[model samples]
Target: MPTSRSSSSIWTYLFLLGEPEQQQRFFKELHFISIVTLSFGVASWLVTVALMQHRHALDTQSASLALVGMVAGVTITALGKSLLAIVVSGSASVLFVTYGFQVLIAATDDPSFWVLPLGVLITLTIAPLFSGIAWYLAVSLCVWVMLGWEQFPAHPQQADQYWPMLAVVVSMLIGLSLNVYFLVLRIHNYQAQRELATMAYTDSLTGLNNRRRFTQSARQLHRSALAPAYFLMIDIDDFKQINDEHGHDVGDEVLRKTAEVIAGIAGEHLCGRLGGEEFAVIYQGDKHGACLLATQLIETVEAAFAGERKVSISIGVAELVKGTDLAHSYRRADASLYLAKKNGKNRYELAAS
Candidate 1:
């Protein structure tokens, strides 16, 4: 049966295009950005105070507002409120923009000109989505306001007028370039991590879930399933003899064929290659349904390899109930599989209730 889509899964696809683990990593990166923003604010404030020794505290009200925003960002992040942290971070970027503009309006060559571009860069790379868009409008407003006023030095020399304007354009371009670099770097890192995770959880030979992934998936399925779940442990009959007679290449082909059969029959069910001629499935069904599936798998394998050497499978079924240990259930299924092998090797056996 098709299961309902989960809210978490939807969020994963929409926001990060990755797993829960990647989302957690994103939150951590956000927290780091918050810290770095706060640190930058502190450093810039110190530079402003040292450079303008004659300016009173009342003259630097924008600096005070930026300080408040930085503190709030730090506190909210410490509380583990990621959404609130993002909001505060965006607000801080806005505050920094106002503060930096004030400083530049006062002294154009005070080494504080970098502050405005820094604020713009923060909003572009790390701020909330809507806030990032709002920042572009804010910047356009600033440019319009500057065009009407004489913020630049009133000198006869043409260099005086054009040099400051050229600096502003270059600074903005640098910020935009940095934003693109950061975005590409983050995407590459995420893709690398996802690939590493896939390698860890998959069986390279058969393209099936390895033992570790199977165990994790089975336990999760056991917890969520509303109906009784059955663990089906399957093993190829006389697998070693086939390897001896037909060579390891044929053995590999047999393993691949078996995996294909299981995948075809299972169809969205939790199944995996549990190492070396053995496979398992966590089937959501009763004993009768489980028996029917086992019988079908046995006959399908036989028919698939009929032209060559005969191929057969033995399956062991064990019911999994709520509040029971999954490891114990697996052991019960394995024991029954051993019994099936002892009782003539080409049939299934059910574990005692």
Candidate 2:
């Protein structure tokens, strides 16, 4: 008889046999639909063998041989097919192994007839091994069927002898239904998680990184030992007055249009919404390049908003110096922006080291 540990191990193996995510990915990534189809065919063969042995008045030796053939067929099917194929094939294999053990016990009266049932009972008791809970239940149901059939009296044409077979079929249907339901739930959860992550890191209004994501990237840049980087703080001049004069909707449109201009000027740079009417840009460039970029941004915004509505911006550029953190650079850029606004709107300022 198998010990409790061995029985537990077998159950664990069966449980892990069906991982829906792995099965789906395997079929999709490797284009293994054909293998999956072939596995279904093999399952049909196992079913045929089981029905034949049950109906035929075969001797214990013949039943044992038939069971072995079924096991081999199922194993081959599992090995040749995809992950899902293995799950179904493994279920059939469990059934055949259980039947073979029973036949061997009946053939030899070596005080082991008791052991066979005990072993099967133990295997079923523990549940299927590492397979998903659904697959484990399915395989367990199949094993139970084999055990139940064996227990039936050997008399041919007994109506009660068919109960075990019916029970097995019912159990299999329940397992398959449960597996499909859980698989769908898992996929839905995965998609929801991905969407949530995207929303968390993205700005909904302007389709840029929000303040939170920008700060994270800034911190990452501070930790690196790359060449000097530039930090620019941009604020729309007289933004509140514009909202008061031209409805908030127009103000919102202005913000969106400004974001597009900033994004264009900060090509390949990290740009994000800092707050209302304020934005930030971080780029790896020298002081001169940073100033030129900032100038170009001011010019572009001025030209774009010219004649349609009066618009201007105040930009502050600061080169990230060695030993300076993101907070320090932001402070310097903010100070420069304040100076620019104070001096005049629609102008750019470069912070001194």
Off by over 4 Å in 2: 1-170
lDDT of 2 by residue, 104-202 (tens): 444444423344343434343323221356565645655554554544434437767565445455655555555545444544665686689779988
lDDT of each: 0.69, 0.67
Provide the lowest-lDDT 10-residue window in model 2: 122-131
Q: For model 2, state the Cα shift of residue 182 in Å.
A: 2.5
Tens-digit lDDT string for candidate 1 (109-147): 443344345444444434222222233334434542443
Q: How accurate is candidate 2 locally (lDDT)?
A: 0.67
